[model samples]
Every structure is written in C-alpha cells, then in structure tokens.
Target: MKLGIFLLAAQFEAGDQGTVLTSAMDAGCAAEEAGFDEAWIAEHHFVPYGLCPSAVTFAAMLLGRTDRLRVGTAISVLPNTHPVALGEQAALLDQLSGGRFTLGIGRGGPWVDLEVFGSGIERYDEEGWAESVDLLMRWLTLRRVGAEGKHFRFRPVPVVPRPLTRPHPPAIIACTSATSAALAARQGLPMLLGMHADDCEKAEMISAYDAAARACGRDPRGVEHAAASVALVADSRAEAVRELKAALPRWLNRGLSAHQTVDGRARTMRDPHAYTDYLCEIHPVGTPRDVIAALRRTTEATGIRRHLLFAEGAGRPERTLDNIHRLGKEVLPEIRADAEQ
Candidate 1:
C-alpha cells in the first residue's frame, strides 16, 4: 500500500495566503524527507477554503522542490477549465516531472467559480462531468482529439508533447456519489474517495464500483483506488482529538462560509463542530498505534491500496508538520510491514 499527504493549504489563522502556501510546500518536502510516497494537493477558487487555486501549477512547483516525492492534484476542478487545455498542462507536468504527476479530476460544486471561469452552472451536473472526462481521456490517450459534447465542441487537434506515461499520467476521479463512482468505473479510472466517508461507506462504494466496472467489461482488480482520511498523531487518542476539535472547526466553518452559489440557490452547509467530531470518529486521529490500526482496517474493508492522509486537520503549520513526521516515521513502517504480511 502507498501513503501520501493531502495538502489542503487552508488558511486557518489571521495571516497572508503566502504563509499557508509556503507551509504546504514545506509539508510536501517534509513528506519526501520522511519517506512518504506522494503529496496530493487540493484546489479551490475564489475561496480561502483552499488557497491554491491551481493544483496543477502548485504540483509543478512542488515537483521541482522535491526529488522523490510524487505530486498530484486531489482534484483539478474540471468544470472551471477546458479539458484539452487542462490536459496539455497535465501532460507537460507529467513529462517534465519524469512522470511523477497524477491528475485527479472532479466535478466541483455550483460555486461562483463556474460563473467566474465562464463554465456556467450547467457543468456542475453528471452529464457535464462525463463529457469533460471523455474529452480529457481522449486527449491523454490518443494522438489527436476532437470534442462534440454538449459542454464543449472542438475540431480535431494534435495532442502536443504527448504524455510520458502511456495513455496519460495516472489519473483518478473524485467519487463523492454513486453516480461519480459509476462514472469512474465505466471509464476504468480509479476512484479518489473523499475523507468524510467511513470504512463501511467506502466498502459499499468500492463494491458498487466493482459491479459497475464488471458491467463495463473492465476488471476491477487492476484498478488501484485511493481513499483520503484526516490524520493526526499524539501520545494518546484524546489529545489528538482534542487538538483537532479545537482548531479544525474554526477553519472548517470559516472556509465553508466563504463559498457562494453561482445561481443564488440555497446550499446547506455542514455544522463545522459536528463535522469535526464525525471526522475524528471516522479517521485516524489518534496515537501511532491507533492510526496504523485504523488505516489497516480501512484498507482491509475497502480494498483501497493508496491513502492520502490529510494531516492538516490540526489547522496549524507546526502541528501539521509534527503529525506528518509521526505518520511517516512511526506509523508508515508498521503499515508497510502489515501490508507485506
């Protein structure tokens, strides 16, 4: 099994965006030094929820900064940019980075990002996501491509630079719902399961994905799916939970409130405090032993081989770094040993 850090670059304290971004980059470098596999970055637009607006761009910067650590986007919001344009950048990064880049695409919310990026709210639905993925796959896999989908229409054009990883750099789809999981399965792409879902829920989603893949004449066993989980390390579970509960709620509430619906539609936001509690309950917010056990149980239940650990739950740079170090030094060796067994 592979383990990586999920870099949210979220601003929790009263400070400039630069500090959050720098801390995030430092975390990525620290992951490499600590012997983790990769670092996945989260993208957000016009919101302080995540300061990195372009995951691909941020990934390129981090790739240059680290020698062995693979860099990827937790998701590059598909609705906000043209698939071909995004593909070109992904290909370029993959080629330049020696194929160490992973592209995780997703259908982001109906936020004001759509209006600002000129994609409109129509692209927030299933059909739009499907079309974008189709075009993206074609661009990545084929020498030339054209799009006649409802969301995009284009004449055939050559795929420039081409991808270093045949068919494209490893790509995954962020699956938040059954429809999204099925969509990924049909395409034979791996699913990037979010942090909010529990082991049981992830197991169910994986089962559904397998069924969908079988229906599409794809072998599910070959797909290496990834799951994200909030992680923190302390001497005891209570201390970890206490640290996360105090700061994560404030960060969550602040960031959640920053989102604005593009169409003025009412959006229900999760209660930050309650959501934090649920995350602690479901994820690896505990001591080294507890974290390793939870991660092992999750992998066993869901058949997920890769994990993106969101250690930023501590909501402070120092605490987050400490968590990552403990995860890499104390927890990782045990997890790898268990996997070998």
Candidate 2:
C-alpha cells in the first residue's frame, strides 16, 4: 500500500500562526525522511481551520524542500479561482518539480467558504464545479482552447509551459458525496475520500465509484482511490487513547463547527468521550499494532490501497513528530507487507 501524509496546517491556538506553518513544513520534511510517498496540503480562507490559503504556493515551497516526495493540493477550491490561471500554476509547478505535482481540485464547502471568498452559495453547486473542471482539463490538455460555457467564456488561447507529465499531471477529485464520486468515475479521475467517513460510508462510496466507472466503460481497477483519516501511533493503545482524548476533540469540534451550521449557529460536539469513541471506531488512532489492525479492517472493507494520514491536529509539534516517526518505523512496513501477501 502507498502511504502519504495530509498537512492540514491547522492553527489550533491564537498567536501560533508562525509555529503552525513552521511545524507543517518541518512535518513535510520529516514525512519525506520517514519514507512517505506524497504530502498533500489543504486550502482554507479567513479561518484557522486551515492556515494555508493557497495550496499551490505551499506545494511549491514543499517541492523546493523535498527531493523525492511528491507535493499536491489536497484540493484547490475551484469556484474561487480561475481555471486557466490554476492550470498555468499547476503546469509550471509540475515542470519545476520534474513531474512531482498532482492537481487535486474540488468544489470547496460548508457554505461559509463561498461567502468568505465572495463566491455566492449559488455557485457552489455541481453544475458550477463541473464547468470549472471541464475548463481546467481543457486548459491542461489542449494547446489552444476556447470556452463558451455559461460560467466561463474566452477566445482560443494557447497555454504556455505545458506540464511535465505529458497531457498534464495527474488530477484527483476530492470526493465527499456519492454524486462527486460518480462524477469522478465518469471522468476517469481518481478520488481522495475524506477522513470523517466511517467504514460503511467509505465502502458504499467506493462501491458506487467503481460501479460508475464500470458503467462508463472505464476499468474500475485502474482507479487509484485514497482514504484519509487522523492517525497517531504510540507505544500502547492506552497511551494513544490518552493523547487522543486530549487532542482529537479539539480538532473534531473545530472541524465540525467550521464546516456545518444549524439555524445559523455553528454545529459542535460537546462530549469529548463520545467524539473520541466515534474517532476510535472510524480512524487509525492508536498504537502501531492497533493502527495496523484498524487499517487492515478498513482495507478489507473498502479495497483501497492508498492511505493518507492526517498526523497534525491539536497535538504539539513534538508529539506529532513522534507519531510520524512511529508510523514510519512500525506501521507502514507492516501494511506494505500485508498488501504483498
């Protein structure tokens, strides 16, 4: 199985922006040294939910720092940016990195991002996202193209400095819903499944994606889907649970509140134990052995081979570093070995 890390670069506390970004970059370096395949960064605006607002810029910084590790945007929010401009930036980064860049694009969410970015909620629908993706693919693949779509219109123009990876670098869709999964499959694109989904949800989503791909006359086996979850590896399950009990709730509450609303109030989970129980049931958060078992169960359930670990959250940098080290030294090899068998 291929292993990667997702750098949320979350700012959990006030007056800690610099520390958060520095720790994130350091984590990227550590992930490379620890034998991770890729480092995916998140993009968010006007919030500490994710400190990095421009995943392409952050990806450039990481690509400059790492020799072997591929750097990608977990997603660059599509509706807020111009597709042609994004295509140019991605192509340039792919060239600069010698084909080490992947463009993961998505319709960003929770309704608040659209309002914050001045892209009204009306534009956050599937039609808008599909139009953006269509324009983006055309920009990346064609030498000269013109679009006459409702959302975008332009004269035929050539894109300079085409990407290093021939037609363009690989593009993966961030799939959070069944509609998005089917869209990805219809386009023959891979998907990055979010960490918040349970095993049953993931299985259903993957099954839907595979069926959609096959229905589209595309081979489902050719699709490379990744499942993401918050992970921490420690000496024992007790140690892991203790640390997670302190940290995961903060992360979950921040995430949930940031992404959802009820009657104009932010949604939140107040009970840490209940939230932690849900997390332990869904994520790979425990000792190496426990993580291995959890991941094995997930793979068995979903048939996914790529696992992306969100190792940084409300935890301290030292603890996050330790978790990465243990994941590299203990969990990854076992997962790979099991995959071989």
Candidate 3:
C-alpha cells in the first residue's frame, strides 16, 4: 500500500497564497526527505477559495523544487477544459518532472467557478464528462487524436513535446460519484477517490470502482484504489483538533472558494455546511495514533490499496507544512514498515 499527500493551495484571502505556496514547497521537500511516494495538488480559481487554478503548472514548479516525490494534480477538472490543451500541459509537466506526473481528472462540481469562469456549465453533465475524459485520454496518450465527438473535435492534431514517460503518463480518475467511478473503471485508469464525507461512501465508491473495473475485463487489483481524506495529525489529539477547528469554517463553506476538501489534511469542505454530519465519520483527525487507527478502520471496511492524507486548508502555511512533517516523520514510517512486514 502507498501513502500519499494532497497539498491544497487555497487561493482565498490576502497575503495567504504566497505563504501557502511556500509552505507547500517546503512540505514537498520534507515529504521527499521523509520518503513518501506521491505529492498531489488540487486546483481552484478566484479569491479565498483557491489560488491554484493551474495544477499542472504548479505541479511542474513543485517538481522543480522537490526530488523523489512524484507530483500529481490530485485532480484537474478535465471536463471543463479543452482536452488537447490539458494534454499538452500534462505532457510538459511529465517531461519537466522526469516522468513523475500522474494526471487526476475530475468532472467538477463547484458552480461558482464554472459560472464565473464561463466554463460551459451546461455541459457539466455525466455524458459531457464521459466524452471529454475519453477524448482527453486519447489525446494525452496517443499524442494524435482524431476523435470527433458531439462536444469536441480535432483533425489529427499532434501535440508537441510528448511525455517523457513511455506510452504516456500514468493517470488517475478522481472518482467522486458512481457515474465517475464507472467511467474510471471502464477505462482501466487508477482510482483516486477524494473528499468522501464518511467511510461508507469511500467503501461504496471503491466497491463501485472495483466492480466496474472487474466488469470491464480488467483485474481490479491491478488498478490503484487510493483513499483521499482530510487529515490533521499532531503530537497530541487536542492540538490536532485545534488546527482543524481553526480552518473548519472556510474549509467547509461553498462560497469561500472552489475547492472540494478541508481539514488541511484529507478532504475538502465542498458544502457550505462544513464537516457537518458527513465529515465527523470520515476525516482522519487527532494524534498520529488516532489517525492510524482511523486508517486501519477504513482499510478494514473498504479494502483500500493506498492512503492519501490532505494537509491544506484555510490556515497558516507553516502550520499546514508542520502537520505534514509530523505525519511523515512520526506516523507513516511505522505504517510503511508494517506494510512491508
């Protein structure tokens, strides 16, 4: 099993974005030092929500700054962007990172971002996502796409500066709903399930993903099924709770920004209601021991193959990076050793 981290670059408020970026870069270096497999980042536009509207560019920047840690766009909203452009950006990042990029595509849900950015919210449906993703994959891996779908079209255009990795860069679908899960499974792409309010949904999503994958003539075990959740681990449970509590309001509200997870650890506060009834059951909070226990429980329930802890939210950059350091240093080593054993 692999342990991952999703670093959120919350674009909200004044004097926070630069600090957050610094903190994230620092944390990336630390995670590499601590020996984690992948470091993911999410995207958002506008103020107080997320400053990182460009995950691929930021991913490349982080790649330049870090060594060893694989950089990922924990998710890039593929349905909203032109597939060819997205592919070009991803391939460039893969080359820049020495083939360390894994693109995580999402259907997108935040209305504010779409409405404001004119991302064609009318096409924000299941069919739209499915078709767009299909085309995006074809373009990303095949280099030359000739797909002429109802929504998108291309005339054998070849994207330049192809990925440094062979064939193409490995990809993950940020599975949220069952429909999305089915899409990912059928495509044989890896699963990067994010922001589940509870364990049951995580289990349900993973099961749906696996069932679909198996049904699609592929071995479910061969595809990655990683669990992404909001986390806040500390030396003490009280301190961990305090850090999350401080970020809870912004992390939970919808109007704050276009994000999906909160807690500065695992998931986003997609709804304006904050963690509410859904978060209490799923987010991994408290001391390192508590987080480990929650993880064990989640694995027992869902058969998760990878665990990704999110450590970004409406908080000080230093504090967020500190949280990552604590998890990497005091927590993950034992789990990795245990898994090896």
> Each candidate's lDDT (Cα)?
0.90, 0.83, 0.73
lDDT of 3 by residue, 261-282 (tens): 2212344435544453345446
Per-residue lDDT, model 1, residue 64, is 98
**Ranking of all predicted structures according to lDDT, beginning with the best and ending with the worst:** 1, 2, 3
Ranking by TM-score: 1, 2, 3
Higher-TM-score candidate of 1 and 3: 1
TM-score of 2: 0.93
Give the Cα error of residue 68 in candidate 2, in Å: 0.4
For residues 1-341, write the lDDT of model 2, one tens digit per residue.
78888888887656668898989999988999998889899887766677888999999999999999988898898887888989999999989999999998888764566666665555567887888888898888888889999788889988897877876688999998889998899878898888778889898998889888888899988578888888888777777778778876776566555664212545444575686777766888777888988888888898888888989843788877887888999988898898688
**In each prediction, how many residue pairs overlap at the backbone (N, C-alpha, C within less than 3 A)?**
0, 0, 20
- lDDT string for model 1 (81-150, tens) is 9899999999999899999999999987889999898888778877887888988998999998987779
For candidate 2, what is the total of clashing residue pairs? 0
Top candidate, metric lDDT = 1
Q: What clash pairs does model 1 have?
A: none
Candidate 2 residue pairs in backbone clash: none
Pairwise TM-score winner, candidates 2 and 3: 2
- Which is the leading candidate under TM-score? 1
